[model samples]
Structures are given as structure tokens and as C-alpha cells.
Target chain A: MACVDDKGQLTASARKLLETIENNALTPEEIAKEAALPLFKVRSSMRDMKSMGFVTEEENGAYQMNPEASKLLKK
Target chain B: MSEETMSQVNSLPRIGSKAPNFEATTTHGTLQLSDYEGSWVILFSHPADFTPVCTSEFISFQNIYPKLREMNTELLGLSVDSVSSHIAWVRNVKEKFGVEIEFPIIADLNKEVAEKYGMIMPEESSTETSRAVFIIDGQRTVRAIIYYPLSTGRNMDEILRVITALQATDEHNIATPADWKKGDKVIVPPANTAEMAEERVNDDSVECIDWYYCQKEI
Candidate 1:
């Protein structure tokens, strides 16, 4: 599980990936490119975030920030 | 395959490019490039089997096989020869020269792997591949590519030396001087700006001939 803090913030690589992901559902490749991070790093972080319920995978293989996590971020 | 694919495969793959993948029959059975992932591989091609020069090269490569294995590297040979021909040639070498061929040889009857690696030399012999060597690293990147005319054989010691240099350079993040071997001091990357160069010179950990060029022991 990712070390998400009380402020709904992910730590280390998970935090970097969470910051890159947006609500419109971006593919991991696009996120990696936008963040200038390696594809493997993006993919591994995505896997961890998805399992931790901080992110969601869409049917088209793109990722979106979970609505609950998004709400928490706003607070 | 399209013209783009033809151009990509027919041309010699450049160093540092991802090695072109292939699956083919070998003396050991069905083999694929992916099978050797995470291990250094020396993929080489000979003009033909049972020839004197090729026989000597094969013997030399076999002699260094154990050393290469100690370095976590594998040897793979290729030619535009059939499986039965490869088997017969390997058996003949063992019987006549008393050298057991332990490594697998690719049976590239259709020149499949040859075209992918641009091993076939039409000028030398339309049917046979030239003596080509590609040193692929554990990450599947082509580290080095060497070619010798069909008449000339390769130096296995030189190949081993190259692998050592590559591994050392990667591990130490330093460059190897020409003809460099293990335990030799390695060349450090030159500083970028004037301020860094000043700092580099005063750094006692490294010996600098000048502000730019430095040598260090790893």
C-alpha cells in the first residue's frame, strides 16, 4: 500500500504520479511524458495507487484520480 | 513486411538500439531473443560451417565460453545453415578436434535472423553471412557491433575485453581509455562550467592531468 498521509497526499513516487494524473483519464504513457518520468516508474506507481484506492483504471487503459481522493485533495 | 520494415531489418542495427527480437530453431531447440533477457549475450554469425577459418573461430569462442558464463554472459552463433547441417558440423568438430560444442548455434536456413541483423554479405557470398559480432548487454541494448570479412576470423579475447569495459563504464559512470583493461584507472567525465572545473582540480579523490581531464580508481 502507498503511504498516503492524513492530508490525502501520496508520498515519494506515488505522490509524483498522483500529481501527474488528471480527472479526464490520461494513459500511463501520456502521464510519464508529461511528468518527464520513466515509463516503468509511472507504471509501477500506477499499480500501487490503483490497489490503494487512490486511483482508478478506466476501460480504455487510462487512469483517473479517484473521486474520493479528488475530494480529499480539495479539502 | 513493409518497405520501412525492410529497411529497418535489412540495414545493420546501430549500437545502443534495442536488439531486434527473433524466434528460431537452434541446436538446443526453439530459442527466442527474449529468452536471454537480463543476461549479456554475444550474438555472432559465421560465413558457413565446416570451413577452416570458421572452425578456428568456433573453437576460440568455445574456449572462452566458460569465462563468459562466469560473467553472466551467453554465446549464441548463427549462420544460413540448416539444423541438420549445424548438428553435423558440431558433431564433426567434437569427433575430429575433441572440442565439445556446448553453446547453441542458430539454424537460420531462411536467413531470418541474418536479415534482421544484416549479417548476410552479398558481395562476400550471396548465400552466407559475414563474420559479424553483436555484444548485447543485459538490458537488451546493442552495446557493440563488429564485422570481419568472411576470410578474417575474430579475436575472442578482444570481445571479452569489450564486455569488461562496457560493464565497468556502466558501473563506474566513467569512460575507458583505448585498450583499457580491468584494474586500470578510469577516465572521469570533464566538468561543464569554469567553476566546476576549479572544484574538480582541487578534489583530492581524483587525479587530474588538467582541470578538464581526470582519472580515478573505482
Candidate 2:
């Protein structure tokens, strides 16, 4: 998410993160630990995903992929 | 300094230039600059192996080695000394100061790598290299350069700061402010057009001191 190019494609790191998050709702820390990425990376990824309406933050600050994003990304 | 020597000193690779590639004998054996292609490099030089200032700098560099590695940055040290000298110096540092120097030190006895990197200050001592640090990115492009007089030791904090700042800017596509460290708010580039500048101030996502200066957390 942080390295998005001019063409608006997800960066390799972001893709790794997204693929790491499949079907799972998790906090940034959890996602980072699970994905074996840094916490700041997960935070940036979640922020970008949230801005793009691809993810939503729960009351506990955990994030989950939106149905629209899942369907769109499924393509 | 002589005219010829001054010209040699000033001939260093500028920022954004490709790093001069080299393969030389190191404490760890023969190594090449290209071996570190997929990682960031902090290629540095010191005056000699057993000098006081250089010894302190080496200890400090070893202190920050773990942190640098976690950030995918490697440290490369060089001096116009022989490999045996480097090995003895590393052992001496460990035995005397109890801090092991793990990074490979290039034994540039022929001054090939030193001259290529402009580490040899003919003015300082043709036989020794002055303190020089080059930050090279994963693509082998020189990202930043710092030169320090041989008398003064390098600041480990500043070295860490520069690495952190450089990595942060690249990853987030933002610039760092003066005295910026990790977790500090980062500078957002100014808008390119007049309309964007007006909209930028009102965007509210970033705090702006003026239309030209805006900062946001990453």
C-alpha cells in the first residue's frame, strides 16, 4: 500500500500483506506478526486499504477486508 | 593540498550516481559490491586499522549492526590496510574493548577500492583513507554521502538517523523534517499546481504551516 505506483496497483509488500490477511480480521500488530512483516508496514497497508474502501476498522481497531474488495480483488 | 590532490579528493561519486563496483580482499575473504545488490549498503572507510578514533567508530558501528540488519542495511568498512592487519585489529578491539566487530573490513592494500570511492585523501595521508560514508540503495545507486575529517569520530546516532530517514522516505514516499526520527511526522511534498496548493491547505489530512509546507503522520 505504501509503494503504490502511478498505475494504482498494489505494491509487492502490500500484496503480500493482503494475501496474508485472507478471510481473517486482525489488528495491525497481529497482521504484521502473522505476515512476518513490520508493524509500521501493516499500519500503512491498513491505512491505504481503509482509504481505498477495501477494508474497515472494527471497534477494537482490527481490520477486515470489505465484501466489495474481496469480490473486486477476486477478479 | 596540491592541485592534483584536491582534484582527486573532489572526484568522489556524487549522490544518485551508481556506486563504483569493486571486489577486494576483506577480513571475511574476497567480496564484491555486487554481492549486496538486493540490500542497502553503508560503505564506509577509516584512516587505518589501529587508530584511536577509528577503533571507537568501529565499536559503535558494531553496536548498531543488529538494528541496521533488521532494516535490510549492511555495513561495509574499508581502509588501505592488509587483511592480516584488519583481522588483528578486529581481534584487538574485541579483546581490549569487549565489543566484537563483525562486519567485513575490506583490506584495500592496493588502494583500488579506496581511490575509486575517493576515500584516499592525498592531503590527509596518501597511505591511509579518510573517513567517508556512502549510502547505497538496493539497486547499487548511491543514495547519500557523508565525509568527516579523520580527527573526529563518526556519530552512530546520526548514522542511524540517516538510514532511518532514507528508508522511511523511500517506503512512504514522503520526506523527513530536520531532526526527524522514526515515529515523527513526515513532510508531504508541496502540490505541483496552484489549484492543488489551495486544496492542499484545506485538505485537513495534513497539517500545513503554509501552502508550501505540509506534514502528516505515516
TM-score per candidate for chain A alone:
0.75, 0.79
The true-versus-predicted C-alpha distance at residue B34 of model 1, in Å, is: 0.4
For B1-218, candidate 1 gives per-residue lDDT tens digits of 69996777556678989998887788765567766766799999998889999999999999999999878788999999998999999999999999998888999999989988988777778899999999998788999999999988899889999999988888889998888888998999899999999999999999999988899998
Computed on alpha carbons, the lDDT of every model, listed in order, comes to 0.83, 0.84
In model 2, which residue pairs have backbone atoms overlapping below 3 Å? none
TM-score for the first chain in candidate 2 comes to: 0.79
Candidate 2 local Cα displacement, residue B103, angstroms = 0.7
TM-score for all predictions?
0.71, 0.72
Q: Grade the docking of candidate 1.
A: incorrect
Docking quality (DockQ) for each candidate: 0.02, 0.02
Candidate 2 positional error at B188, Å? 0.4
